[model samples]
Target: MVRVIMGVKGTGKTKQMIDLINSAVHSEHGNVVCIERGGKLTYDIHSKIRLVESSNYDMGTFEFMKGFISGLYAGNYDITHVFIDSLTKIVNADVTDHTLEEFLDWLNSFSEKNNIKFTVTISADRELASEGVQKYF
Candidate 1:
C-alpha cells in the first residue's frame, strides 16, 4: 500500500505525483490528500483533492511527519490515499538517513493496516538511496 516516486531534482517527479493525485481524485470514492512543503501544488492537484501544506504545521523530522500523517488519518477516516511530494524537502532529512529508512518501513505497515495507500516522492535516485529503501521506488 506504500509506493514511492524517486528521482533527482527537475526529473518530473512532482508531475508524476500530480498525475496520480488527479487521476485518483477523479476515481476514488474516498478522500484523497496530497501533502506538499508549500503552496506550490495549489494549482497542480485537482480541486476535489485535499492539498495540505506541510510547512503550515510543525513538521521537519521523520517522527513528526509520521505522526502528522497518523493524525491526519485519525482526523478523517475517509481518506483512502495520501500523496506526499518531496518528503525530504518537507522533513529536512537526507534520503539516505536511517531516520527516513525507519519511517518508510513504518509507512509500509501503517498503510497496510489502515487500508490506505501512500505515495511519496523523494529527491533521490535509486543509486543514491540505500538498498533497503530502493524497493519503495
Candidate 2:
C-alpha cells in the first residue's frame, strides 16, 4: 500500500515519518528502510532499520527516484516498509505538478507488485495537493 503524509513545510512531517519508521521497525518482523535527501535522520532511526541517503545517488528526476526504489526492492527482498521523507525535495518538483500523479501511480503499482508498503511525506497540505493525490493522505 502507498500512504502519504501531507502537510506544509516545517510542519514536523519528517518527525512524523521518523516516528512511523521507528514504530514499524519495532513492531514489524520484516526490515524497514527510510530514504531521505540526506543522512540527517540516520542518528534518529533505530540501528536495525536501514537509512538511505538519496542525495548520494543520482536521483534528479521522478523516474530516477522510481528506479532507485525499484533497485532497493531488487536488492532487498526482506524490506516490508519504505518511508520516504520529503517526496517533493527528492523529485525536485512542485507537488501540484503532473509528475506527482505519475509517480504516485507508479508507486502504487510497485507497492502492489512487490507486496511492500510505502509511506511518503509530501511537502504540501491536503488541500494544496492535487485532487487525485490527496486520496492517499
Candidate 3:
C-alpha cells in the first residue's frame, strides 16, 4: 500500500504525516519508520517509532536515497509503515546518471517487491506536470 499526500509547504502535510504516525504507532501497534530530510519537524513517538535523519539538506540525492533504502531494510521483521517526509527532496537530490523518471520507476518497483507500505509527502510546487504523475506511490 503506497500512498502520497501532497500539498504546498506549511499546508499541514508534514503535520498530517506526524499525526498519522502518532496514531499508527500509538494505537495500531504498527512499526513506523520516518525518514526526516528537511531538519524541520521532530517529535517524541511511542516505542513503535524509529526516526532516521537522512539529511539536513547538505546531502545529495544519491546519498540520501542510498541511506534511506539502506535504512528501510536495515533490520529484520515486521515494519508496518514507512514514511518519507518529502519525496521531492529525494528525487531532486538524486544526481545520479539515471533520469528522474527512471529513478522513480525503480523506487516504485522496489516498494512493490518489498511489500512495505509507504507514504511519500511531496510539495505541490515540486509536483511534476506529466503523464508519469500517476506512477508516484
Candidate 4:
C-alpha cells in the first residue's frame, strides 16, 4: 500500500504522518519500518519502532533510490510496514527537474515488486513532480 499525504506548508503534514505511524505501532501493535527524510522523526517522536533517518547528505536522486531500493529488498522480510516521510525531500537537493520520469518509473516498479506499505509526503507546489510520481505508480 502506498499513500501520499499532501498539503500546503504549515498544514502539519509531518505531524500527521508521525501520528499515523505512531498509531500503527503503538495502538495497533504493528511492525513499522520508518524512513525519515528530515530530523523530525528522531526529535518529534517516542516509540520503539524501527527508524531509518536519511537527511540532506548531498545524495542525488539515483543514489538515494539505489540505497533505498537495495535496503528495502534486503530487509523487507523482517518488517510488515514501511513509512517514507516526505518523498519530496529525497529529490530536493538536486532539484534537477530532470530524470523525474525515470525515477518515478523505477519507484513504481520497486514498490510493486516489494509489496511493502509505503507512505510518501510531498509539497503541494510540486505539481509536475507529484503528477509524474502518481502517474508512474
Please give, for residues 7-101, the per-residue lDDT of candidate 1 as tens digits: 99889998888888999987888999989987988987789988888888968888888888999999999999999998999889898798888
Cα lDDT tens digits for candidate 3, 1-137 = 56667677778887788787778776544467877775554644444577767664444565457555755676734676777777666556432234544545655676677666677787764345244544553
What's the distance in Å from true for residue 28, model 4?
A: 7.4
Candidate 2 lands at a TM-score of 0.94
Candidate 2 residue lDDT tens string, 20-111: 98899878778898889877898888898888888888577998988888888899899999998888888788888989988988899998
Encode model 4's per-residue lDDT on 20-117: one tens digit a residue: 77777765434677777656678655567777776544544665765765676586565556776666576563223556545545655666776655
Tell me the deviation in Å of residue 29 in model 4. 7.7
| Colliding pairs, model 1 | none
Winner on lDDT between 2 and 4 is 2
Off by over 4 Å in 3: 26-30, 44-47, 56-59, 62-67, 90-100, 135-137
Top lDDT model: 1
Backbone clashes for every candidate come to 0, 0, 2, 0
Per-model RMSD to reference = 1.0, 1.2, 3.8, 3.5
Give the TM-scores of the predictions, in the order they appear: 0.96, 0.94, 0.70, 0.70
| TM-score, predicted candidate 3 vs. hidden true structure | 0.70
Candidate 4 lDDT score at position 76: 50
Q: What is candidate 1's TM-score against the reference?
A: 0.96
